[model samples]
Target: MSAAPVIVIGSGLAGLMTALTLAPMPVVLVTAGRLGQAGSSPLAQGGVAAAIGVDDDTSLHLADTLAAGDGLCDAASAREIVGRGRDAIMALESHGVRFDRKPDGSYALGLEAAHSRHRIVHVDGDATGAGIVKALVAKVRETASITILEDCRALRLIKRDDRVVGVCLEGKGPVAARAVVLATGGAGGLYEATTTPLGNLGQGAALAGRVGARLADMEFVQFHPTALAVSAPRLPLISEAVRGEGAILINDRGERFMADQPGQELAPRDVVARAIAAEIDAGRKVYLDARAALGEGFVRRFPGIFALCQEHGIDPARMPIPVRPATHYHMGGIAADCDGRTNVPGLWAVGEAACTGLHGANRLASNSLLEAAVMGLNAGRAIASEMTAATVRLEPVSLPQMSDPAPVRAIVSRGLGILRHETGLRAAICALLPKAGHDDAAAVALAMAVAAFARCESRGSHARTDYPHKNASGTRKLFTMDEAFAFARELAASQPLSRTA
Candidate 1:
């Protein structure tokens, strides 16, 4: 270490866990808003997936994860992470998290889509994320070794001799660090309708890619099947647990649309989302009906969702709740190892911002929180053991302009929605390439568009209208900003603009 404090950005679950695990070591935790008030961690409705039930084991959990990943997941990585599922749950509890329990004092595990057993450890029913963050925030605030910087945004990375040394903030200029960790969440905000905090615009991937870090699986974006269909800056998510509880998807004509699907409403998210999108595209409105299933028990099972539905003038116990597919998660990000080590020596990433090949093409339900906690703990230990002392002097670094995702949202949403094609992707790349150099959002969007174009087959969440079938063998794609930009330019020249519709 350079004797400077380790700088952790984003203040979400991964960042907080990383800071806490580095206890007794000096750490500076920075966030764009008040701690626990920003990022997607607090908005997660589902609980953490762990194999702690009587009949469940790590092997079964790994099988479900691999199945959802759609043939692209790294089997070794998935097995290792899933094997540590119980340890991650215990680690969170030690930080003051209170998971819900049954009347017998055992853990109350809930079931979600694609799981073989009931293994979701929740807190306060559907408000699991809020409950977890509340306890962790209180614990983090009281810790003596961690320093919290509120309302600070990271603009770029400061590199020296091919190693990342610090981060340049919006107004605080450059802050030197022994090592830097990026946990800035996912790129769902790049879409018009998303369930993430609007500020999460793939900032981690953009910052890492600008400094030559390899980005992986940029084409796979998961769309949640049941975001409450209403006008808002961020859509409210109706948890998959709702469907797990027997709520069926129905059209306005009262026909159960997913009845004939492989798993019906409980299929993998890509299957359900595509089904709903097809219904809406054909001039029919889709809804989730819990009236015949939950009835009076709806509020007790999912109080948070029930309250949100009430706010929108719909009662789940009486009438079906209108819903549509919305961008919920990104399985692609800065490529890293299980310990969060990136291509660059002193840079690390965890949570949704790091693509460790654990999620592959699609993520299993309730697995995001598990990955975040496990990776954060792994990264902290790795950094403490490997970081070395270096004689370094602070240098003045020029901060880039503050990023605006507004200009890139329409292009990303148009070309990178639930269904994609080559023409829309090429058009998106053509428009985004000009702005990518100066705009962080454009840079991230361009990289995703390039990857989507390169992938000529439909697999998992990446459904291509042009190629409607999966290839015999699926391989993960990785890119750097320079490589993506070069490909975009070549593609723009290879075809006429008139070919894009």
Candidate 2:
């Protein structure tokens, strides 16, 4: 094994921040693509959320976060994450990110759905993610303590005694490190439609599951409401900030249907996504009407969305954008504390890959960047406090064979996309569990279906159609991969092959 003291297995905000915070400690960063290309962070259009307003306090931010989590958020974790918001903003600024400022010299905060106050910090009006990543990548490249390997993929965790001692890379082989941080991002690619980068197939979660780490909230995948309905692998994302700026959703009949609903156009993502799905399912086409609101300034203020629209041959100034729901983020992941400590010792996770209970069942808009920065810093500091290098031996490894993800992706899109049902979920699992032997995503897909199947009521982003109500009381479920598979096998045994899960 290569003798890097610690190995971070991604190059997004969390991995970069973790390495940067570790400072003098040398860490190896392994990325599957270029430094900022394949990561979901670079594709984020909404800004990071922070309570930096005089009218806003940490308590309000905490309240909003808990409210969005749908009774599943860990109070302490939410407090710690939201409390550290200002410092995270300062830290990002120190790394050379310039947030948009108002005329009076305070931050130009924007409002998103479900937030009671204006507390979102952005950059370049609509290119917050790109701006943040650009600054961070510059800082990381200049730092002498970090070594980067582009196009190197981390395949599995190398555990010696129930603890991750190193990571096994695809072609570069295993790199040994006592502390391994899994900052690999979400699994939105598990479905046919997504706003996430195409490679975000929950590899980190699957690896953690294989190593016996407990996963939570697998059923609560958040779908964004306004992905452009184009025939692309990843649909172009129309930022939620536009809705905050007064854009309204309309169907083919030019009717603003969301006007009658609570929160109007600015409803929480899950509610809006469900509404959009209902429209699409009823053979009605939904559109985002920005022409009347932003008009000419739309092209200037939000060049990213404008460029996307123009590139697709539709002018936002003249016509509304066709829209539909697509998988955006996964709220459930490898359950971890704020320090990013997983159930397995020597293994840590942060960013979208770790379920820190801050997002609960639904992620408040723009809170993901906040989680990545705060929790990444916390993980780095925690690891720095306990630095003891030990000699480790490298073992030969073999990767699991994976087939084309399209078939399973189609199943996930049908059964687990926006709404879920018992029969459809059972069919998805029954189709996937057999294919699980050849593909890793199949297992992750099966896990999600089983988790959705187990939770017999709707809560937050996980809406079960057959069980169309929220349970009176239920805690987050923590289960192993074996347990999920066992449940699948049992369900398959209960019925005939033509009707079984």
Candidate 3:
């Protein structure tokens, strides 16, 4: 393995920030598409979470993050990440990111659910993600130390003995690197209904698994509550910022449903998602009534969403927008430390693909972007401080992609969607167990299904409808790819899993 140039996989905010942090040092970025075009970072609408206002403190932000995580958040990681919020934002600003500012020259911080203060730093009205990505992409293109490899998807890890040396890409030779960073985001694309790009089918997790990196909290998948229920395949998101601006969730009877719940319209995202799911399951149509909340200014405040609604023949200023729950985020991934180093040497992970325990059971609103920036920068700095330069040989290893992903995707959605039951998860395992290694997609799907089935308790984003109460053993679930597949095989050979938990 070479130890001179660092290699970053995935070109979302995390990857870009990491490469930018290690500027003046040679780095290579491998993306499945053009930079900032394929991943969920550019699709983020809500502003990044931070503790920048005078009324807000990092302690309060940490508390909200822990509360949302359902006791799964690591206290130290939460403190470290949330504690660095202001500096992260300032660092981005220095790189040409334009955030919304008040007339007094301070930031116009907006509020999202689960926060006690208005500390959501936004830009171009509701285009916080687009603004950050645009600036970073421009900065990367201008930098001479970074090499952008567009249209290259990393299919597998090139490991020697126990450590990852490089990656094998689709239709290409193995490229050696000193250190490899994974920022491939989430597995939401495995679901038929999701807000993330369709290509995010958990390939990164599978790659890490093949190299024996420990994956933790694989059961907690966070479903966003308010995807616009247009008949289209991929749903457009209705920003939670719209709800923060006073919009409310309502049912078919034109009643404010969230009024009866804690935090009302601004409850934790898990609670709100479940509430909406329950409404839809009960044959009631759910809608976001924003006409009375923002009126004429809705068009100006959210021009992108407003235009999306208009294209679908709905007017947000006059009518309630139909909404439903869709798989939005994965809180579990490659288990890594605060420095983004995985258990495997020379391999690191960050962003949604890394489970640092900062977001335990559920992520707080808009914290995804914050985690991306902070952890990406940390990974870059950590590797830069320790990398050793040396020459090495490159070896390409044959790895398998998922075979027949459609059936696996359907099973995962039915078994592991908003509300999960024992029967559905087991059946999903039985169907997916046979194709585990042949398809990375099926392997990742089986891993999540098995973890969800083994948890046998409800907590955070992982709600088990059968075991409807939280248990005292609030331990995190960890796994290896072989371990997960072995369990699935044994269980599949036995009698079917009973639903009488």
What TM-score would every model get versus the actual structure?
Answer: 0.98, 0.97, 0.97
Q: Can you list the residue pairs that collide in candidate 3?
A: 402-439
State the lDDT of candidate 1 residue by residue for 354-433, as single tens digits.
99998889999999999999999999999888886454666777766765677689889988899999889988998898
- Scored by lDDT, model 2 comes in at 0.88
Error of 2 at 366 (Å): 0.5
Error of 3 at 29 (Å): 0.2
Residue 372, candidate 3: C-alpha displacement in angstroms = 0.3
Better of 1 and 3 by lDDT: 1
User: How many clashes in candidate 2?
Assistant: 0
**What would you estimate as the lDDT of candidate 3?**
0.88
The parts of candidate 3 lying over 4 Å away from their true place are 1-4, 401-404, 496-501
lDDT of 2 by residue, 1-501 (tens): 345588898999988899899888888888989997777998888799999899999999999999989999988999999999998999999999999998999999988999999999999888998999999999999999888989988878889877788888888777788699999999999988999987898888888888888888888899999999999989999999989989999999888989999999898899999999998889999999998899988987789999999889999988999999999999988889998999999999999999999988899999999999998899999999985776798878887665688887888988887788988888888888887655778878888889998999888999988988889886787787778888889988886356323
- Writing each residue's lDDT as its tens digit, candidate 3 over 115-184 gives 9999899888888888999999999999999999999888888887677777887777687778889989
- Number of the top-ranking candidate, with TM-score as the measure: 1
RMSD value for candidate 2: 1.5
Comparing 1 and 2 on lDDT, the stronger one: 1
The lDDT for every candidate, in the order shown, is 0.92, 0.88, 0.88
Q: Using alpha carbons, what is the TM-score of model 2?
A: 0.97
If both were scored by TM-score, which would come out higher, candidate 1 or candidate 2?
1
Runs in model 2 with CA error above 4 Å?
1-3, 499-501
